[model samples]
Target chain A: NAGVTQTPKFRVLKTGQSMTLLCAQDMNHEYMYWYRQDPGMGLRLIHYSVGEGTTAKGEVPDGYNVSRLKKQNFLLGLESAAPSQTSVYFCASTALLGATGELFFGEGSRLTVL
Target chain B: AQSVSQHNHHVILSEAASLELGCNYSYGGTVNLFWYVQYPGQHLQLLLKYFSGDPLVKGIKGFEAEFIKSKFSFNLRKPSVQWSDTAEYFCAVNVQDYKLSFGAGTTVTVRA
Candidate 1:
């Protein structure tokens, strides 16, 4: 099963450019998320959606936007790219249970903002 | 505010050596713990998780972790390492609202 997939594995952007990263899941999960990984910074949450059409901000939501229009897809957008946004971005989704949560992650999108 | 920490920034070991990596989270209430591995040029995959019931959870690839509630720690361990075990490991804590806080990650290098 192609549990989680991300499009455009690598991309380079100029400052102030806009771009979108697409994430798709085939497991029919209810929760989707966006995270960025940097040296010594871990994978900080950028945005998340509980279900289709519902979005929420997480620990680090600045300079990023997310949309979940379909149950199987979540999109992350960078309105104005900056050097700070140059990091490996990962998309993850999980099936919702009562309290416990488990995640299935995509390969990742390597973005470079020059 | 909740956060996760992985103590080992990097580790090098010979094949067949025992492995232990420390992970800790800062959360007052109930929390979900997870260990994910990212092999070179690959995606992150779940190694194991701790929800409840038992403190120790075994996952694929002969990996396991012990959850010590009093210590607020969930340390990952493997009885023996293999050359194929070289990868980056991440520790995470699932907080309320289904958001995961990940650690900085530990890079493990196993020499064949």
Candidate 2:
């Protein structure tokens, strides 16, 4: 089964442009998250949804927005891309919350903003 | 805000050498710790995790970690390493909230 899949595996955007990264999970998980991975920053949470129709800000939510219209999908949107946003984005999903659950990660979407 | 810290940014060792990567978290109280590995051009995969139990946890690829509550540390170790062990390792912590904070990551390079 494809646990987590991220769309637009690679993208290049000029400054001020907007784009969205799609994350779809077939695992029927209840929680989903968006994270950005930089050279040394590891992974920083951008936004998350506990379930369908529920979204919350994460550690690094600025400049990014997320929507969980359906339980299977979580979309991360960059309203206006900036050079600082040039990083690899990852999507993750978990069947449960807290320490008991393990997160399944997507392959990642590499975005470059010029 | 809780945070995870990985002491080594980069580590290089010859094959068959013992390997250890230090990880620490700032959160007190109960916590769940995790170690994730990312091979070149691949998605992050679970190396190991500790929720609650004996404090010593073994994971895939002959890797293991020890949880020292007093020290607020969860260090990963492997008795012997191989060239295929080369990858970026991350330490993560899950507190009460659903959020999981990750460390800056440690790049391990095992040479043949």
- Cα error of candidate 1 at position B12, Å: 0.8
Clashing pairs in 2: none
**What shift in Å separates residue A8 of candidate 2 from its native position after superposition?**
0.4
Tens digits of per-residue lDDT, candidate 2, B1-112, equal 9889999999999999999999999987899899999999999988999989899999999999999999999999999999999999999998867888899999999999
Best model per lDDT: 2
Q: Which candidate's TM-score is highest?
A: 2
What local lDDT score does residue A30 receive in model 1, on the 0 to 100 scale?
Answer: 94
Chain A only, candidate 2, TM-score = 0.97
- Cα lDDT tens digits, model 1, A33-62, are 999989877788899999999999988899
lDDT of 2 by residue, A1-114 (tens): 988999999999999999999999999999999999998889999999999999999988899999999999999999999999999999999987574558899999999999
User: Which residue pairs collide in model 1, if any?
Assistant: none
| Clash counts for the predictions, in order | 0, 0
Sum up the clashes in candidate 2: 0
